[model samples]
Target: MPKLTIVAFDGTKFELDVASGSTVMENAVKNSVPGVEAECGGACACATCHVYIDDSWSEKVGAPDVMEEDMLDFAYEQKPTSRLSCQVKMTDDLDGLVVHVPERQA
Candidate 1:
């Protein structure tokens, strides 16, 4: 299992022990973490699950693919580290990943 930290817009942190191959949006939706709307249900059809990758873990998580990158353009407060949580698959290499939910969805 890997540790995933999701910081809500209001600064609350939901620390989760996630299985490899699970997605950040899945865990957040499962645990009821606020601010991660996940409206598309991990289908990458929407930008409601947008989040910012923490600087420290950005390199390991890598950049979003072309599709996700295109979707992120609709995310609120999009930035250099913006990513769609659904597209971020958990793996052993990303054992300690951190993401921050934006104040609102697209």
Candidate 2:
């Protein structure tokens, strides 16, 4: 399992133990972390799971693909490091991954 640190717009931090191979959205929903709505589940069709990858983890998480990039346009306050949590899979290498949830989702 890999650990993830999810930071909320209000600066709350949730340290979660997430299962490998699961998406960040899955972990958030399962743990009831606020700001991650995941309205379409893990599907890339929605932007409710939007989040900002921590600067330190940006390169590791990489850039979003074309479809994901398009979807992100629908998110609130998008940033260079913005990513749809549903598209971010968990792995051992992301053990200390950190993401910031915006004040609101699209």
Candidate 3:
């Protein structure tokens, strides 16, 4: 398992021990992390699960694919590190990964 940190808009942080094969959205929703609505249930059909990858982990987290990029256009306050949590699968290499939820979803 790897550690995942999700920072809410109010600066609250939810620290979780995540299974490598699970998606960020899955863990966030399962743990009741604030701000990760996951309205589309990890289907990538919406932007409610939007988050900003911490600058330090951006390189390893990598870029969003074409579909995710398109959906992000609807996210609130999107940024350079913006990504859809549903599309970010957990992995050992991403241990200690951190992401920031926006003030609001799309």
How accurate locally, in lDDT, is each candidate? 0.93, 0.95, 0.94
What digit string (tens of lDDT, one per residue) describes model 1 on residues 2-99? 99999999999999999999999999999999988988899999999999999999888899999998899899999999999999999988888999
My TM-score estimates for the predictions, one after another, are 0.97, 0.97, 0.97
Candidate 1 residues lying further than 4 Å off, grouped into runs, are none
Model 3: CA > 4 A from native: none
Candidate 2 residue lDDT tens string, 1-106: 8999999889989999888999999988988898999999888999999999999999999999999999999999999999999999999999999999999999
Candidate with best lDDT: 2
Give the per-residue lDDT digits (tens) of candidate 3, residues 1-106. Answer: 9999999889998999999999999999998888899988999999999999999999999999999999999999999999999999999999999999889898
In candidate 3, residue 35 scores what lDDT?
88
How far does residue 87 in candidate 3 sit from its true spot (Å)?
Answer: 0.4
In model 3, residue pairs whose N, Cα or C atoms come closer than 3 Å (at least 3 residues apart or on different chains), thus clashing, are: none
